[model samples]
Target chain A: MSEFVEQLALCVERGKVNRESLYPPDLHGQDGTDELAKQALEQGLKPDTILEGCILGMDRIGAKFSENKAFVPELLMAAKAMTAAMTHLKPFFQSGAVKRKGTFVIGTVAGDLHDIGKNLVAMVVEGGGFEVIDLGTNVTTAKFLASIEEHPGCSVGMSALLTTTMVNMEGTIKAIKEKYPETLVLVGGAPVTKQYADKIGADGYSPDPQGAVAILNKKVA
Target chain B: MTSFERLQNRMVGNPVDRPPNFDIMMQFATRHIDKPLRDYYLDHRVLVQANMAMLNDFQLDIVQAISDPYREAFDLGLEVSFPEQSLPISTSPLLREPSDLARLTTVDPVNGRRMHDRLEAIRLFREKVGGCTPIMGWVEGALAEAADLRGVSTLMLDLFERPDWVIELLEFCCEQAILFARAQMAAGADIIGLGDAVASQVSPAWYRLYALPYERRIFQAVKNSGGIARLHICGDTTLILHEMATSGADIVDIDWMVDYQKAAEISDNDGPAICGNFDPVKIMLQGSPEQVREAVINCLSIGGDKNLSAAGCEIPINTPYSNLHAQTAALSEYYSMA
Candidate 1:
């Protein structure tokens, strides 16, 4: 762990996006994840190593979130910081010089407009090394099926905050299974239960984002 | 004793004849009226009809002026869309820019469309149920109102990126809550409910710092206005139980994720009298009548024999009439033994 990588990890964990982005006042005016990642690449640190830093940062925060030691704001900030760092690695990923884990396509089910949970899961999954195609909130079943068709091997995820909208997960899962039975579908939200997942025929359910990451890894692995 | 007398007695930790039942129901009421659920929000007449019908049918306590959370945002002059079959959506968030906060004006609840609709509901509830039943007026707390006005994501980031602006926004919304509570209380609301569901999203530290003080202020203001305050935060609020207890509310509605018995223990029966903590969806909606009765009994023992019986939150409308009736059986059966 060199200075820059350590600094980058620290930045991601504390949610410092750039030198001027003053979130964690302790590191105010310090080079954040964005600057540190760029400097690391310039200093000949491999893109994979920098990405490992991002993953490490996310894992630390994600684990804390699982333990209830961190809440949505902290996890969200870390994700924002991770995104800042990932911007530097995007070109390498595009050029095939960097690789990613499997894709995870996620959304809030139709008639449910909440994206906070879906966004949190997407960020954590992306940090876990998956290429996340976030379909955003109020996503219809047709949109989900079309996304799965476009990304044949992608694992599907859906979220719903409202109890009224949670039932839609059942229909969406059934529709997906009808078209692509082999595709894995995951469901979660405040209202969703493992029992409900079992009832709905969803392949998996995770209460927290890191748990979602672990489930995605199991499927991909 | 009537249900209102039991609730009034229980508010101060007095021994009631039996525990009183108090849960919010929109779905069950919607089914009773045979109208679109959307009508409940759009028409105060329909809202009152549904509420009165549920209370009359189930013999439940609390004639409430509660509806969706966005009514305050709508009253604040943000354009809100009511989808025919879906929840209301605020088309434009009020806090697009920090400057937008300054441009905002206070909402006169009597004059604002949705606020007046709720005021009308409160007046109607009072006229219908009056002194016989406890009537509750609802208001969204700072976090919920802030999220409504300032998009939730933006509000989340603002906590870190724009702390000063977040406070200002919250303070603005706090005043909004105070205004809403004041108006509702003056309009014959016996118990004013402050629903800050998003308070659970922040850490206990953040909640204590940013959210709790404002909540205390709102509750205090409600008290000054001669109104009882009810605090309801809609998630697992285990970590902040002690702080919630200190907010000067007459009752705090616990969610299903938390153990009501545990909450009463943690607060030493000194916290606002605990209401709720039952799984509305599971017990009231999905459970058989026997299960609902057993649940109420379980709550009585766990919450130390003196608390209001409320669902973990709101009961879904589709819950069977038998299960809803079973909610009342808990109280009657307990009294029968006494």
Candidate 2:
């Protein structure tokens, strides 16, 4: 709740990456998340406390997106700001001075080259404190299994933008569950619905990025 | 009545034999004719064959030239690759930096290879079904073309990072789209469908600022050229439904996530005809014929007089023939009862 931490949260929420960043003109020439985080740490603030600022900022922007009060541009800017602040916290995370919520592996299912929806969820989830492993586009069932083996207990998220490709999510989920029965699975995209998620036996379905964060948080909680 | 007459009449709330089956089918059409997606995209002859098959077999009323979104981007110097069995993709965006905007040139649709291919398709459609069916040619919405050339995420960030540059890029894209749309119209297209799938992802404010004006311009050009303008934006467009209604288009595609009743209410009496609001994945692809029939009936009932029958977007390529038939049958049955 100190001055720098508060400003850092504001910077992330407004998407001001640094002082040189001209975005969000209201905060022009002001210290961004990068400077605020460094200053907060130099003043002996706990890394965990500083991390709270990032989470709070992302949560605020994520909620706005969910309510239709904001859109992809705002969320992308917030993620960029969060990434700028995370650069300063990376060493703390490596040294075990900070901890992440969980791991979420995501990808666009096979035969569907669209990645905008998948990437949005990955960025928002990362800002929500999860370690995200984005497998990129055209991901097959074998790739999902391999990533599960690499990151044990990591929840999986699959995306498909086409109706034809959405069926691929079912086969991919079935293959993942067959190998790692305990791994949580989620499916989402423009064509995916909650009913289809249930039909495909996915653990959860989210219509938006913050909704994905909520689902992932619920499972771990 | 001819398919062309049915569609034109339906848009103006005139009585027709049945609601026009305006389902957007590209992959499904390719599968119906058993052609590779690449052939369907790159070869106008293959595209014409696929569409003709859909018209004969599934009662589809529109012969469309919408193979992929890359035609404009590719002709504008973007690196596009068409996999044999997959949709086209542009791995490397053309505008990597803000200054890269200078690299874009105004492309003549008639001279550009991919754009010319679409014109060829329009010409063929006119030759084959000129008077009987509506021929729809397509172009990307300006914002969508910008996203295609600059990448979705980067352009999104650019909207905030460099507002003026984004506007300039949009202006360039708008000019190209207008040119491509005009070319198609000249080549015998009765209707021009503009796909702005990325527009649904932006907030209403951004949509009004960056997307709507360009859409207005393109639709205005289509109308001025004596062509029907159809606007198709994929995904849940509930928030911007009102704005979409005012975009100068004659028909606006309503995706499944949007409420059909709400769309009709928002458009009211003076707006464009509502063309869809069914779950292409759940009800059309995965549902039985009985379910598809009921969904079409329900959608048409909600959409009222100014409605065209269609799935929310493209039907899945593997959709059962019976399910597709159910769509046409439902229209006939519903209208007969009324």
Report every candidate's CA lDDT: 0.86, 0.91
lDDT of 2 by residue, A67-184 (tens): 9888888999999999999999899988988998999999999988888889889988988888899999999999989999999989999999887688888889888888899999
Q: Score the docking of each candidate (DockQ).
A: 0.73, 0.80
Among all windows of 10 consecutive residues in model 2 chain B, the one with the lowest summed lDDT is: B262-271
lDDT of 1 at B166: 88
lDDT of 1 by residue, B298-325 (tens): 8766775557888889887678888877
Clashes of 1: 3
Clashes of each: 3, 0
Clashing pairs in 2: none
> Every prediction's TM-score for the first chain?
0.95, 0.96
TM-score of 2: 0.97
Q: How many Å off is the CA of B10 in candidate 1? A: 1.9
